[model samples]
Target: GLAERKKVTHVAMESTGVYWKPVYNLLEAEPIEVLVVNAQHIKAVPGRKTDVKDAEWIADLLRHGLLKGSYIPHRAQRELRELVRYRR
Candidate 1:
């Protein structure tokens, strides 16, 4: 619940293809801040490829406030961009 996360500050999410959009929109609706970072930026060194470990790494980076979020345009701007893209 959003209420339960009142004390929670920042939430970090890896920037996959386009899966992070809905999640970002939902969280943005709340007061909580959402950070979308490049997957390469948060990935561990070579030979450390595990889902659990990847999640842990992201969490650790987010907890320490080390990850920086990429720019996200306003919804209206996004819609306009989409319209232009489809028309092209």
Candidate 2:
């Protein structure tokens, strides 16, 4: 399935709560460029609150290079996250 998906050059996601780890991991494992953006940075205006449209908006911004990428640890650092979480 992963081979089917086109090679991703970058990833953009709205930074919500602490629920972004897995999402980050999935993308990071592919070794593609990743970006985590602030939700407020991409908040939609009135009458444009649909999920589909919101995703489209994010994609649009990413395409035009308007999205700001957040920090993602290197593979070693990411491994530490697993150890920290599992040990808890």
Candidate 3:
């Protein structure tokens, strides 16, 4: 995996609706700290606009421990919520 290849210890990603869920799930089991940051928070900090530039900015922020991760429920809780929704 890229993370293993790079020996990354932490990862930060912007929360964009439900898009971050799958990626988060994939990373959850890895031996790494995964931070799902709010898009609003990222936008609140002024930075470059291009995707490449945005990635660089995010990396810099993460490296400096400036990113804040949003709360994510445990896998069991998430599954329960999904079951309840399906039942409804």
lDDT to native, each model:
0.83, 0.80, 0.89
Better of 2 and 3 by lDDT: 3
| Model 3 alpha-carbon drift over 4 Å, by segment | none
lDDT of 3 by residue, 1-88 (tens): 7778899899899999888999999999888999999988887656577878878888999999999899999999998998999999
Error of 3 at 24 (Å): 0.3
Candidate 1 on 1-88: residue-level lDDT in tens?
Answer: 6835577667888999999888887888766778999888877456667878887888888888899999999888988998999999
**Alpha-carbon RMSD, each predicted model:** 2.0, 2.8, 1.6
Could you estimate the TM-score for every candidate? 0.82, 0.74, 0.87
Best by TM-score: 3
lDDT of model 2, residue 46: 61
Looking at candidate 1, what is the lDDT of residue 10? 74
What's the residue-level lDDT of 65 in candidate 3? 94
Worst 10 residues of 3 by lDDT: 40-49
The Cα error of candidate 2 at residue 86, in Å, is 8.6
